[model samples]
Target: MAQGQSDPSCRRSPPPGGRSLRQRYSGDHLQRILLVRGLLKLLLVVAVLAGATAAGWQPATAWWAARNRPKFDTLAAEQGDVIEVINSTGTIEPVQSVQVGAFVSGPIVGLHADFNGEVKEGDLLAEIDPRTYRAVVARDKAALAARRAELERGAARLQQARREEDRSNALAERNVASISESDLDQAHFTRVGMEAEIVMAEAAIEQAEANLDTSEANLGYTKILAPVAGIIIDRKVELGQTLAAQFQTPELFVIAPDMRREMRIFASVDEADIGQIRLAQESGKSVQFSVDAYPGEVFEGKIAQIRLASTTTQNVVTYPVVLSTPNPELKLLPGMTAEISFQVDRRDGVIKVPNAALRFYPVRDHVREADRVILDGTALEADDQARGESPSASAKAEAEGERKRRHVWVVEADGLLRGIPVTSGIGDHRATEIVSGDVEPGQRLVVGVAPKDD
Candidate 1:
């Protein structure tokens, strides 16, 4: 028997149904069974891989998030003063100012004072030409003298009239002269006419004297005098300038009273902030200000007056607040712009944090639900819902009346952020006072998330 030939027992003959046994169990049927087994093994391997991935998805994602998170910028709570200030702008002016003007009109002949000249009260500031006034005075004096002479002449005539009347009356009584001659003499020597002429002459003399006195006063007025002791900030008249008093009095000099002694600031406080200003004229709160002329140099003053009348510009209403300060060195000038601030409140030796800390919010991935601390309100109940809990009814009621609740984050020893809710008292733009909180001085606080690199 050949090696390749099969035994007669192994080689099956055709069956009675006309199909051989070898054909019934062919290679194609075995190949189909092997393929089905291979498919089952591949499905089992895929199921194992899916199970492994499901078991590690959470930790893998957590690790990735930890590595890719943004680092935060931090600030430490400090112990210092926090002052709340109300800001405003104003102009510096002298406490007292006067405008010197000419009372009499004449051509200016002499200038005794110039710009920036110091003067005292009753000091001669300028002189006007007195020729016209002097001429009027001379004319009035001559007229007065002429009127006095007229009075003397009238007095002599009155005396003659009186003597004549007496003689006529005596003649009538004696009966030595005719009655018609006596009557004619009495009519010619009427006493009322002589007395009337004397009165008229006296009236003319009085009028002439009054006119002369007026002319003398006008001549005296030609010398202009300083009304107040001050420094002349402005001189408007020239040596040859002619002033006219027919209309309004033209200003010749502007004097600032005691420029080296004191100064005043007129600040325009908004209507909304006027209520915050206290009456400080009689030793109330003090205010601080700075001028552009002297940078970084602060000057202090007190409120002198708060005008009740409001001024409206572009529909914005403001009130004038007067502040006075001493300027002994004369460093401040009139009309210089000053930036002012009123300290409304201040706190010292309190734990304070940057305003950025109070306003900082972490990204969604960085928020840890287990680390939230709600201090003084039930407003966090919505946030608690994620933890499968709801706030109590008492907490909800208390939240309605609770003072504002603010929070800041502190870094833990394990390099994780934890929130600390605090009771805030006072605040400014840069810092806020922490009245009650778990934080203390010298603690690092998360102010803001670090900016990303470009």
Candidate 2:
């Protein structure tokens, strides 16, 4: 046999299943190629799905946006009262108050007045210990009596000296008396000395009388009296309480004269509001106020005084504005807090705009390009910085001249925003007075974008 040819017996035969080993291996390799093709098909399907999803996203978002378009918040311009006011909290006090105190140092022996008690002028409010004062008065009286007795004795002595001097003169004239010339001179000197002593005694009596009067006055002071007819709002002294008035008068009571008739609210108004307060006073506008004690009860007052003195606290200056209100009911008490409103100006049936409308800022895209210049304050700043420019001096001057001119937004029928210039007057927290503007009553003014709901 040649090397290239094999014997018939050496060649292998097919298996009983009629499949050779080469054929079986060929089948397995074909199955693997088919499985690889199936995996490629799966990957292609996944890629197609991803592409489809990406392509549909924008349309889905558009449909949702069309369905839930942004609605704007709006307010209507109308005719109403535009009231400008300055509000503040103030402490209520009596229009006039008197402080009663002890002039003499002594223990409080009796209390004749009570807190919140009504009193008249000269009514005894309290009493100090009178025993010591009475003793002083008695001593002063005795001293005065002694001075009078001394004065009487001195007068009698002066009369006797005068008579002695007369006797000496008679003896000298008759030239038959035992008295010598030196004795006559001594008598005259004694009479003169007696007269001087009598004068001194009279002065001592007057001094003693003054001392007695002072003692009596002090005794009277022991009984504390109300200086004016009023209600006792406070009492500082209790029975048996000692008061030391050596340095200063010890405050014993506080009386408010005719507090029921009128109560004053000392409101600290900002200096910025002082001018308006003066204007309100000149205009005869009544101030509206209420107290915590009567939350629902409103009280009316007039500007009584606007003090020139200003109080400074933390770089803020405030002037004291005194508001006088009639409190015939006596419901407003001292130290009660009052919420007051000083109406600076009031205009009725005037075109007014909502404050929100004035403060609203519109989206840049929502506004027209020409009106986008006044879209929002922050945007305006950014726009200015980008342009490297600022408002011109003439523009600023024009804006200042147009004191009430401001820019506001309105929605056209096409659902886009357009800014229109408006002239405003006095305003309050809720609305501003429209002096002149293209806007009319009942016209809807865009405030802001309404919130989207889920």
Q: What is the clash count for each candidate, in the order shown?
A: 0, 0
- Top model number, lDDT: 2
The best candidate in terms of TM-score = 2
Question: What's the CA error at residue 321 for candidate 2, in Å?
Answer: 1.2
Residue-wise C-alpha lDDT for candidate 1, range 1-454, written one tens digit per residue: 9898888998666788887655667888878878999999999999999999999999999887767666789988889999877899999999888998887897899999998898999999989899999999999999999999999999998998888777777777888555577575565657768889999999999999999999999898888889999999899999999999768787889999888888999999988777777533433778999998889799998888898889999999999999889998888998999999887777988888888988886554454656543431334655565687656899767764454467788765545677888988778789898888898888888988777655
lDDT tens readout by residue for model 2, 1-454:
9998989998778897888756767878878878999999999999999999899999998888766766789999989899899999999999888999888989998899999999999998999998888999999999999999999999999999999999889988878557787999899999999999999999999999999999999999999999999999998888999989898889999999998788899999998779999999998999999988888788999999999999999999999999999988889899999999999899999999998998887778888777876656556656766996667999778766655767778887656788988988989999999888798999899888988777
Report the poorest 10 consecutive residues by lDDT, candidate 1: 370-379
Which residue pairs clash in candidate 1? none
lDDT values for all models: 0.83, 0.89
